[model samples]
Target chain A: MTDSEKGENQEMLDVFFEASRAQDPVPGSDLMARILADASQVQAGFNPAPAVVSHPSAGQPGQTLLSRIFAVMGGWAGASALTASVCIGVLYGATAPDTVRSYLPALDEQTAELDYSYLGLLDETVADLEG
Target chain B: MMPLDTNDDISDDALMVLFANGDGQAASVLAYRHTGRVLALALRMLGDKAEAEDVAQDALMRLWKIAPDWRQGEAKVSTWLYRVASNLCTDRLRKQGGKRASEDIDNVPEPKDDAPSIESDLIARDRANALQAALETLPVRQRKAVSLRFLQELANPEVAEIMEISVEAVESLLARGKRGLAEALEAQKMELGLDT
Candidate 1:
């Protein structure tokens, strides 16, 4: 951690490095050849696909349209889940009396009114669809 | 989309890609370039030539198998190979129940006489033996960090990348490993007349 400690470590490392560099590693020529031979044998087992083409016309337009609609619905569902989680977290923080002290308590009244208006709109939309 | 050429200058990653496409020669080149480093690391870690050879071969073979899925520029090929080879050596060492009793290096075969003068060869061998003994005393991770950083001449970041640790962690390991080696080598130093 200190400068002297760092210098000593570096010096020792240099000595070890120099000593290791001086020693020659024995070659394994036959082992290397065998390994490559085995590798080639494994490579020979692979069968690559030839060139191919796909026609968009092979798919029906109606099926593609339905797939897009389902994809959009899935995206909406995910977004709704995320939004609901955020709203729940916010609401929980807002309503908890301890956390309420950290913010302007007067703002909660106006937020409740806005929440009612939003819920009323949801109800009306659902009722009209059911009717 | 260009055809891969064996004689052309290619990076290790490119060679890996060619090997993936079934060019055995590309694999051979990679093996030639990296095998010595891997074997040397394994030899230091395992202290047995036969096991080191097995570890090196297995590590290189894994490269050939994973060539198709290898993402380029992510890691140096030799660095990755050292990591794999070291891991294999560690696994074998663990399975064999920690360190084997130290063997007499006097029986170990020396390189051909043409490589070095007899006196120099003896001195180098003695130093190498002292290093090996000192290295064996360190814990496995420290030994690996020291070996990769010092022996392989890999930079700190490359050593950290291979060891799958942060740079700070690598530094700590190297510090501890070096101190341990220095302590172990002190007596050997007196014997080798390195005190002067």
Candidate 2:
């Protein structure tokens, strides 16, 4: 098209294009509502799930104090072993075994003498034996 | 206290991120901000308000879905919406049997009696209807280029991005499309009050 014709055509089309702009439709309220509802629904999936926080020092949140103590003592096995040891100690103390007295120095003036000669044998060198 | 976010100043890109992070207010703000333009473009493309509304809603819905993966600088959210709405309109246009839903310009509906009756308002409405009718005559790509470039008042490069074509290609299509529109409406010029 000639430049003159082109300018004329553009001018004419500009009018129509302008009218089209003025005529741009407003979306109805229902449409806006639907759009937002869709957005919200889709966004529902986007929310990061709340982090599961474990308190390091709080043990288990719901466990009883006795249960926590049991856990600290290594469950039932440790508790049973501790109970058995306490009972054995009580029996030995009550009965006053000579075997127990043999290891410890006497509370009275008399003492259970421990031999140092046996320790001297342990100190003897393999070289002395070989010689 | 942090001031309540009017979100008026927030860019659409940031709004999309907030939306993805489950900020309902951000979604609300972005939806209101963009859906109108998207609807307008779809209206131009499909030439039917209901269909255009459907296209707009679908585009935003896709935006919501894509928000989690939205690469902030890759494309503006509004530009992305335009591209999505344009593509959706294109799909529907193709399935339209290569013919407009309203085939005859003669059948363009008269304004409702309940509508505003100002002379200028009526004139502008008539002219728009005529243009819309004429637009449906060109090929889909031509129509899209014309709508985005002229009626929607988007820059050439932005149109290219939306159409996924080069700016040069967009200019060429616009040239041809305007020519086609002028020819189609030339016969109706006097009726449309373009004789001025």
Candidate 3:
């Protein structure tokens, strides 16, 4: 189209565009309330209740880090099992218990060979066991 | 906590990050700023206040949902909103499969005594309604293009981005849309007070 034609088209449409734009909705209080409500509701999901904790920051700042960890670990029952596991670990480490190694007697073959000579242990041990 | 009023001075990207970080005030600030812009576009596309409001609400809801993952500086809040509102309007228009022809003539504010003649206000309302009527005659894509380009006053590149089409495609749609609107308005120039 010629410049004049384009100008005419734009000019002609300008009046209508102006009028239409003037009547553009202002988003009334009710509409605003609803939109804000929806925002809050959806944001509620993004920032959920503190108890369904997603991160360290999601819990109460007043609470100790240890308590927070316990809360995250499923409360008293988890803490109880965790406590038992810790006690067992401390006992095992302090005493260096060998009952488990005694049960897995075949492991003795490897440990015994590593201590002495593999050929002497394997042959002597095999012969004695067969006899 | 950044004060919600102070958030007005902050960029939208900052506000989005604040919102993602669980700043309740940030949501309020963002909502206060962009809901009207989104609603205006949806209103033009849907041609019904209630439906447009619903679309606006849905669009804002989506923004709230995506807040946690809102990568700052990657996309603008306004552009993202316009794109979302435009798509929601398209879905609604397609589902309706027909023109939505109501404009709020009844809701036009009562003319004040100090204002110009009530007749002028009436003329302006008539022209707006007529333009809306003509807009309804457009294909949905053209209607969206015209609304985003002309009514929303967005640049062609931005319009293209919102419409997810090439710049040339946006130009084509707009040219065709303007031509159609010009022809429709030409037939009613006298009624539109353009004959003066």
Candidate 4:
């Protein structure tokens, strides 16, 4: 097409588009309300920064360092790990003596005096019986 | 930390930053500012009011979610929104398998104020409907390029940004779309009493 023809065609399309532009729909209140509701729900938990339980400046001015550790580790993951560690320590304390006694038979009171004085005779008897 | 009543004075990027910083009203401002364009784009792309509304809501919801991580100076919020809405429209069009699945004028609900006020306005409305029908006959990409570039009056660069294509590609699409629209409009000109 010639430049004039192209220009005219473009002008024509412009007019058509301008006319149609007015008919474009505006979003209604209900849609806005729904969007705002989503925003509210999302913003409910949105903090500008992550939690800082262990910060040096956190808690009372005279608080001890140990208190800070407990405060910081009080969250779910930290609390769960602490609980598991305590349970394991208690379990080991409860079962360690019995496990050691079984492994070392002399530690058993019933078997503490089983010394055989005639070791040579016993070995000779065992050999002769096998023969 | 943005003060209330400051929304109107702040840029969209600023509003987004405020929203990310836990300002709830910032979200409301962004949504109100951008929903019209998003809805209009979806409506033109999908040709269904309800689907367009859904697409608009989904796009803005994505925007809301991305507020925290929104990098300043990366892109304009409006351009980002147009892109999201465009992608959604494409996904919907792809799911339906073709542009033929888009709703036609009879099925799509138009605003009551869209009714013609005069004979010329009536012709314009008819031509617009014809244009929309012709647009739906196009491949999804071409339709999107044409709608965004011509109807939405976005610059070639902005259209490229929204369509995620190079400027030359956008120009090519616009040329092809214009040809198709011209041909379609030519067929209906006499019937609609438009100037030749």
Candidate 5:
């Protein structure tokens, strides 16, 4: 089709399409009501589930006090464990001996010879001069 | 504050704010106002009334669940609901292996007429069925654009927001979709003697 013809045809088609769309029916009222009811039921079912609040009178007085104490003790124990872990880590980092040098005997001898030479008391130096 | 008397009088954003503040009535009003439109959109997209109803109900349920955390003015509530419902419908269609092709568009009974010729009524039914079939054959996005713009009477920007596409994309989809529909209906039009 030519451009003008295509445009004309498109316009006609648009008219028909719009008419058909206008003919489409709206959804029924009962459906909306049902959906609303279902949503309300869902909302009611939520409501934070009432948080399972424990009434003061619901538990025995002695059990409540014991539970409170246990909770506090559990928290303190967790904090103490964490602190102890940190302290141990710090002490190990600060005071641990350098075993890396002790692992190699050759490295220890090289260090001793270097120290004697620095003090001007090397036996090798005297022997070389006499030769 | 006194409760809003009319659902239409209150904007969706305002309703969402009230719902966020724990207003059950506001939630109900919002649900009642938009459920039908969302259900209809789902029905047209999914081509099954029951599934559409399920999607609508599920969408509203989700809205209520999220109402407490909903931020007002962030988005239109209806637009949000449409997106959710559309996504749900798309999921259902995918899971069902796209077995929705056998929609009852063919069985859309003609309007009753006492003084009509059988041939004319048959012609009209054929035309309507052809249009429905053509619409069904388009890609989902194109079909959605066509339906929302023409059928749901939503504007371009609103359709864009609901479809989560740019306005230009919506226009492109509608243009291409209409061309495809025109081509598909051309043969049916010839059969119905309306092509000329």
Candidate 6:
């Protein structure tokens, strides 16, 4: 087609299409609601979920008061400190068994007098009892 | 308190920014502004109202999903939406083995009797339905180009952006599409009372 003819044709199509354009099919209300719902859902992702109050339950019986204290002491550092404390207590108990005995008058004299000979005497007493 | 008119005036890019910032009203504003165009394009492309509604919802859903990542100045919001809607319609069309559910002309929505432009409205409605029928007969790309350029009144560049084609390619498709439409419309002019 000639340039002039093309221009005229385009013009006619424009008018024809303008009418078509004006008659945009009204979207059903249900569709709009669904689309809006989709929008809300996506936007909801940006918000943080609501915080729920935690409660002690039967399943977590191991969460004793001491363990709870250790947990509250914060993460690995606190846990290491708690473990170190328990290790120190155990070492003191094992290496210094007489420390508490020395504090008691009844154990004080006996513990002070205790020697390797006492072990031999105990062994003989056990043999006599068995015999 | 933000004035509601301010929301109305906010650009799509700004509205998107607000949406990303967790402003719920911004999403509503954006949806209200563009849903009609998206729905119209899908309706014309699919020739099925139900499918068109699906496409519209899907496209807007994508829009909502992409709000946070929406880049300002990268593309026009309408262009992005129209492209998404177009793809959805294409997918639906493909699923039916490339056959559109042929719409009976009688089922075409009639102009309301109380419409001020009743006479003209009737003519336009018939012509529009005829055009839609003719559009369905074209290749998918041609139909999309013609519908975007003529029916949607998008500029060649805009149509190209939505179709992901060069403007020259868009023009070519539009030319060929218009020719096919002309032929189809010519055959229907008598029955549609275009001559009268």
Q: Which structure among the candidates has the greatest lDDT?
A: 2
Model 5 agreement with the true structure over B17-107: per-residue lDDT tens digits: 6766656678667866788778767766776666777888889888877876787788888889888988887788779875655656533
Clash pairs (backbone) in predicted model 4: none
Task: Report the C-alpha lDDT of model 1 over B139-160, residue by residue, as the tens digit.
Answer: 8999899888878778999888
Q: If both were scored by DockQ, which would come out higher, candidate 2 or candidate 6?
A: 2
Q: Give the per-residue lDDT of model 4 (tens digit) for B1-196.
A: 5575654878988888888777878988888888988998888888888888899999988888888888999999999999999999999989988736445555343544745577766766666777778788888899999999878889999999899889999999998887777776766666866575
Looking at model 5 chain B, which ten-residue stretch has the lowest summed lDDT? B106-115
Question: Candidate 2 regions off by >4 Å?
Answer: A48-131, B1-5, B103-117
lDDT digits (tens) for residues A25-99 of candidate 2: 777799999998998788877775688896434578798888878878877899999999999999998887787
DockQ of each candidate, alpha-carbon based = 0.23, 0.41, 0.33, 0.31, 0.15, 0.30
lDDT tens digits, residue span A84-124, model 1 = 99999989877896666558777777777674568889999
Which candidate leads in DockQ? 2
lDDT minimum window of 10 residues, candidate 2 chain B: B103-112
What TM-scores result for chain A when each predicted structure is judged separately against the true chain A?
A: 0.30, 0.40, 0.38, 0.35, 0.35, 0.39
C-alpha lDDT of candidate 2 relative to the true structure: 0.83
| Model 2 error, position B175 (Å) | 0.8
Q: Where is the poorest 10-residue window by lDDT in model 2 chain A?
A: A106-115
lDDT of 3 by residue, A1-131 (tens): 89998897788789889877776767678877887787778767776686853675467869988888888988899989999999999998788658767788899888777755678889999999999
Q: What C-alpha lDDT do the candidate models reach, one value each?
A: 0.75, 0.83, 0.82, 0.81, 0.71, 0.80
Q: Which one wins by TM-score: 1 or 3?
A: 3
Over B38-156, each residue of candidate 6 has an lDDT whose tens digit, in order, gives 98899888888777878899999999889889999999999999999998888888888779666875335434444567677877787777777878889899999998887787899
Task: Give the distance in Å from residue B89's predicted Cα in candidate 1 to where it truly belongs.
Answer: 1.7
Ranking by DockQ: 2, 3, 4, 6, 1, 5
Q: Higher lDDT: candidate 1 or 2?
A: 2
Error of 1 at A25 (Å): 0.7
Of models 3 and 6, which has the larger TM-score? Answer: 6
lDDT: worst 10-residue window of model 4 chain B: B103-112
Check candidate 2 and list the clashing pairs.
none
Interface RMSD of 2: 2.8
lDDT of 3: 0.82
lDDT of 2 by residue, B88-181 (tens): 9999998887768663453333344445558977887888888998998999999999999898899999999999999999999998998999
